[model samples]
Target: NSILGFQGNRDLALNMINWLSSDEDLISIRPKDPADNRITLSRAQMQGLFYTSVILMPLAIVLAGVSVWWRRR
Candidate 1:
């Protein structure tokens, strides 16, 4: 019943609704640009992101906890 497109899909959606309503004034402005909709990663970047999230973040937290405990002692 609705339409779909990959690029600039948001504009198509608002236009579709206006068409269905048969009222041109249903929307005076186009919808805001969608968020950066694509997620692209190179192999190195992917590995780095994975390590940062899965390893470095937890390591940093542990280090911070140790530092706090050491300071208290």
Candidate 2:
């Protein structure tokens, strides 16, 4: 019941069910290791990404829209 959110939730549940049913052979199989691929961002890098995506991007989009509107008028 506590295997929720795990990568091998199904396998874990199956193993637990097998163990409970005394199916030792079925419970012999083990789940594969989940990959650990993480990115470590520096403070500067984090700030740069935040500004670029959150601020600069929306500002650029708005400016472009306003410019187009002005040109059209």
Candidate 3:
């Protein structure tokens, strides 16, 4: 299943099924270490992202919709 790109708790479901069926072999494969690709932003950068995504993008979409409606009408 790990070959299919699923990385977390793959054997957990299988183990649970085995336990339910009273199977003796219980698999306990360790998890792979996650890659360090975390982002670190300053307060100003976070605020900019918040405004752009939460406020400005929606406002732009609404404005475009209104413009199209006005032109069509």
Candidate 4:
């Protein structure tokens, strides 16, 4: 399950990057359009980002606090 989720996410991320980096026109990428110019992210992607922020932000704050404490020591 985890591996499948990872592969699905990897594919989604790749598609997003491809769409974002493409040189196609903006209006051509709308939902009503016929071109495949838009990429979609799954709920896992959203949750992954949220979880990453939740974990990393506090870790960064702790690291910064430690750095300040060490400097003052």
Q: List TM-score per model, in order.
A: 0.52, 0.53, 0.55, 0.38
The all-Cα superposition gives candidate 1 an RMSD in Å to the true structure of 8.1
User: Which candidate gets the maximum lDDT versus the true structure?
Assistant: 2
1-73, model 3: which lDDT tens digit per residue? Answer: 5554465455667777778888847756656778999999999999999999999999999999999999999
Cα shift from native, residue 6, model 4 (Å): 44
TM-score of 1: 0.52
- Tens digits of lDDT, candidate 2, 1-73: 5656577777778889998999878975575778899999999999999999999999999999999999999
Regions more than 4 Å wrong, model 2: 1-33
Model 2 earns a TM-score of 0.53
Best-matching candidate per TM-score: 3
Q: What clash count does candidate 1 reach? A: 0
The global Cα lDDT (0 to 1) of model 4 is 0.68
Which 10 consecutive positions of candidate 3 have the poorest summed lDDT?
1-10
Better of 1 and 4 by TM-score: 1
For each candidate, the alpha-carbon lDDT, in order, equals 0.81, 0.87, 0.81, 0.68
User: How well does model 3 score by local distance difference test?
Assistant: 0.81
Better of 3 and 4 by lDDT: 3
* Runs with alpha carbons beyond 4 Å of true place in candidate 3: 1-32
* Residue 27, model 3: Cα distance from true site in angstroms: 17
Clashing pairs in 4: none
CA lDDT of 18 in candidate 4?
68
